[model samples]
Target chain A: MSPKTACFLVIGNEVLSGRTRDSNTQTLAHALNAQGIILSEVRVIPDIPQRIIDAVTECRARFDMVFTSGGIGPTHDDITTACVAEAFGVALRCHQESYDALNALFPEEAFNQARQKMAWLPEGSTPIKNTVSTAPGFSIGNVHVMAGVPSIFRAMVQWLVPQLEAGAPLTMCSWHAFNVYEGTFAEALTTLQGDFKTIDLGSYPFARDDKHGVALVAKGYDSHAVQEAGRALKSLLTQIGVTPISGEPAP
Target chain B: MSPKTACFLVIGNEVLSGRTRDSNTQTLAHALNAQGIILSEVRVIPDIPQRIIDAVTECRARFDMVFTSGGIGPTHDDITTACVAEAFGVALRCHQESYDALNALFPEEAFNQARQKMAWLPEGSTPIKNTVSTAPGFSIGNVHVMAGVPSIFRAMVQWLVPQLEAGAPLTMCSWHAFNVYEGTFAEALTTLQGDFKTIDLGSYPFARDDKHGVALVAKGYDSHAVQEAGRALKSLLTQIGVTPISGEPAP
Candidate 1:
């Protein structure tokens, strides 16, 4: 059977408007890879309520787990918490433990209306540990809501990935050769893909300041088959009259 | 009036597998912003046919224009052309001009079957110029297909964005201050947002080398409103006892 699937919702106007380049998707991808969960899809949307609600509600039902990043802060533009709650048809409430804990972090008169907003979560939601900031992320049902900050989002993924159900971890073996054109070896790569029923073979070309090459990668759940494919990849590179490196090509 | 909306589809197994970081989305976002088009959403999916067909069909129906990057090459994994054809219910036909142009780039023995595949496009498609590579990208209806490579994708966007309908170009006015917390001034920022009727005001915080600050940006099609918001943003920062710097904070 295939592994369980996960979908990531990157919610914010910054990404959609090109004000920020997102790193959370890459971080989540690697973390899920380690957890053996297939990250089936990712969606980046603006901080609009209807968009967030639609994506959160739709992905939660389609995938095994859903992760949402951004718009969870204590500001006016931050509306992810309310939107997710609306998606689940639940009301937002103050979790006593979270409120008290966060309240203790600030001195009297320091915790304003905005800071207090961070303590409020969806009904019956459980707080995820937040080591970077005082405000904690929350998980309600299969939807995990986390901060938009790269550091906080990464921390939440590290803590949450281990808790999810795992399947067979993906393994990869790759070889690279410089001064080789990809089209010349496309037929061989296609045959290799056909031969290895379980493996997903890929040819990725790279061009440096002067050097050009292709990285032939064999990824699969079966480690032995992936290794055999790696050997074949190196041999193919050698037959093309180029020295083969045993891993990804250098920058 | 709301600007024309666009959506981006990042198609590749490399991005979904965390093997490559995508830069095409940012390129498209900036390009559309210049054209005064609102980038509504972005989706990253693996190179699966069903996913491609579904996204292509769905996005074309929802948004004014759609851009797809990646999976157009001479390799077996490059099946975007065929999938796009299926999405439009059209046959794949070789464009004679493109075929002859690409075929002439290589010697008779070197132009193999794999290399020839790049010339096949969806029926009734228009070719987009690709200066970086010999293979031309294609435009079918409102969906524009481009190469995944950063340079090639950027070139394609530059060539295509001007041909589309022009909207009011998005303009911005921004000011940043040092050592000002976003939450501390959240109430004021919210009030400012309420006052700026025509501008979209945003507050973004940054921390670098033991320094923390917030960048308040005012963006809109109305240039006058954005400039007025910028002055107010500067005054707000000065009122909080921090020196305000014009434009984005130094990295």
Candidate 2:
């Protein structure tokens, strides 16, 4: 299958202001990559309604799917749900099923007061079940709106990813060479990368305990191609007179 | 002292495509928070030259400082230096100091071929010396352009942060209560949060070994105010018959 592309829109003033460190982006990226759905863009915008609407609308048009995190909480700053509704030209109304779920956990009178704001959903959107929180998430078209909390966001990803068609997972292999400078290995790595047109080759240089080394990672969809490239990489490293550490096979 | 605000522009297609996970944001956030410089915003844009220019220009106007990661490499895709030059309306040229450094590291002819691209910097920008690699980073106006690699970015942060003025570091304290659900302590935490106007309180609910609990964190500029809030939180937790686990004092 061809690679499926997606974008993430992280909406929160707290994150922008660095009042909070964002963990959701990394979590989503790992989950999507495991399923072979490439996340192509990530935009962190403020709580401004107009910005959210514009970002959601633009991202939805460009990517196969758009996932948004934050601005669905029970605060004045939480406006993602409404902005998403406006972007999709849908009406914002209370979802009865979500209300029932909230009410089932708490007293109706109290839950109504706390969750009335959360029940607001975009027209024609199906609610994404929230196992971690009373405030349920929803999906409008291909845009999945999930909570900002890491635990809750992770739960939603597990639920949502299986529903979407995933592309072939990329296979990767790495060769680590110690006591080697990046400059020394640059030519060979670059040549290998050029030869392997379908694979992504990355040279990550690191300094540890007064020793410098580079980890060469090769990634592609075809397992045979990846293995072939790995064998070539090992040969290249040996020819360069560097003892490369052959680690366990890449998962 | 008034709060110092900074913004980060992460320029890379690899990060946006989920090909690489970003650790620079968290490292910078924690480090900057310790120095009392608040990170106001972070935008991860692609290698698109126009987008990089737009993000840098806007962030420079909005925040006291702007730090950009990625796009500073020897490859063709590394266009951050050029985009930054365009943003500042300056000509791109090879920095002599960087060229000299590269020449010292490699044969003159070989250095000229590979390091010439890394030497390209925006006119009038001061180079941020990279002790780790030959690729010299630079700072122009209020924007500090650094390498995307985590180690290089981190070294730049350590080198650059001490040169900037920092506001008072915030004092933070936490109180944990185990085996107590958030519902049981929600009202008290909310009430305490309301009473402490100067302090910012965050209630985090966690599940551990089939048990639920809440961790109440209080942060503020004033040490005494944080301590007072912490004491009040501890008393409230005990009053609710929830056993409290006191953590380290606010730093």
Candidate 3:
């Protein structure tokens, strides 16, 4: 069975400028992989209007789902919501639920124009609840927009992933053999891939404690095929005169 | 003066599969920023030929420079070189320097077909020296390709960045205050941003030891403008009755 595809968009000037390290891509990658929604691509873009709109419009059409992190905060640089609205050709409307949730968090005066900006979302969007900050993320069509803060982005993922259409989980297995150079075993790995055409196979080289090794992985929706590929990988390692570890190499 | 714009492409399935955490983006981001080159976009794409070709073709034309990591290894999945050649409508050619370097690393018989694959590079490309590994990465037109291994990637970057044309370094300054709500001060930030029209300003929220604060940063190539914006941020904090802390908040 073909897995659903998703794209991740990380929008922030801080990320582009090296002021912030984006942890959200890995978080979303792990989350989507678990749900069998293959994370096909990830783009970390600057907080610019045309860039944001272009990425949103392009990725949304190309993939089954598009998830964006950052640029939803209550600041002058936070232009994601507006750009997304522009991308969808929709007007901004007061999301009453989010407005109420944010309103209750602060005193009347504290809920200033900046705070009110959080309440204006793309028209006809569904609000994704935020427990960290009262300002909610929203979903329109296939695109889900969330916060950029690691803590908040995680919370939103936790809330959103479970609600997504459950998919068949991918089966993964790995075998690593020490002192095995990738170039030495590249032909065998390629043949193994051909033998199990449906399975996704790759070899990654690693260096640890002055020793080198190659970690081979087999991934697919078919459990039986993945296990068969694992055994084939193990047999290949043994054939190459090295002891195969059942999982990835120790860091 | 406008800084040169660059785009980074991280080409690997391991990253998309969550099998690897990409450290190269942050490394490249910092390196590019120090050179006064703005990293406008970054894409972490899978090890797919069409995707690599499309991204390389599009980004090379779009940005002043493009940097790519991963998919240049000897393994079968490593197709970046050929794909990049295809992107430019060129052919693969034996980069004699890289070929000679790799041949020296191995005994006559040990340097097999798989290892020989690393010697072929995109036509008309100049090889970027790789200190960690014998195999070299190559640059074609505006796109520079390097290894994905953090250490090797770092070494290649160190060698590459120094050779590129240098530009004016960006000046950065920040001011933070505890118990500062972002929404409460967002208006002042907007006004301040208008006042310092050329400077790029932003406010980042942080929570430390159960207290929340907002750190305002002013960044630009103009050193005086950045410092002037920093003083304005300090005044904004003082006006709101919170003592401003110079630099970012303590973790």
Least well predicted 10-residue stretch by lDDT in candidate 2 chain B:
B202-211
lDDT of 1 by residue, A1-251 (tens): 78889899999888888888888888998988887888889899987899999999889999999999988887788899999999999999998888898789887687899988999999989988888776888999999999887877888888888998888887888889888777788887788788898888888887767777788888877889989988988888888788989888774
Model 2 error, position B192 (Å): 5.7
Model 3, C-alpha of A204: deviation from truth (Å): 1.7
lDDT of 3 at B121: 90
lDDT tens per residue, model 3, B176-204: 88877789889988999999998999888
Model 3 regions lying over 4 Å from their true place: A208-212, B207-212, B249-251
Give DockQ for candidates 1 onward, in order: 0.71, 0.27, 0.72
**Poorest 10 consecutive residues by lDDT, candidate 3 chain B:** B205-214
Per-residue lDDT tens digits for candidate 1, residues B47-69, read 88999999999999999988999
For candidate 2, write residues A1-251 as lDDT tens digits: 67888889988755653445677887887778778887767877766788788888888998999999886865434678989999999898889988777668776545534356788899999998888876888998999999887788889988988778877876777787877655565666667778988876665555556666766666667878888888887887788799878742222
TM score of chain A per candidate: 0.96, 0.90, 0.95
DockQ score of candidate 2? 0.27
Task: Please report the candidate that would top TM-score against the real structure.
Answer: 1
Interface RMSD of each: 1.2, 3.9, 1.3
Higher-ranked by lDDT: 1 or 3: 3
TM-score of each: 0.97, 0.80, 0.96
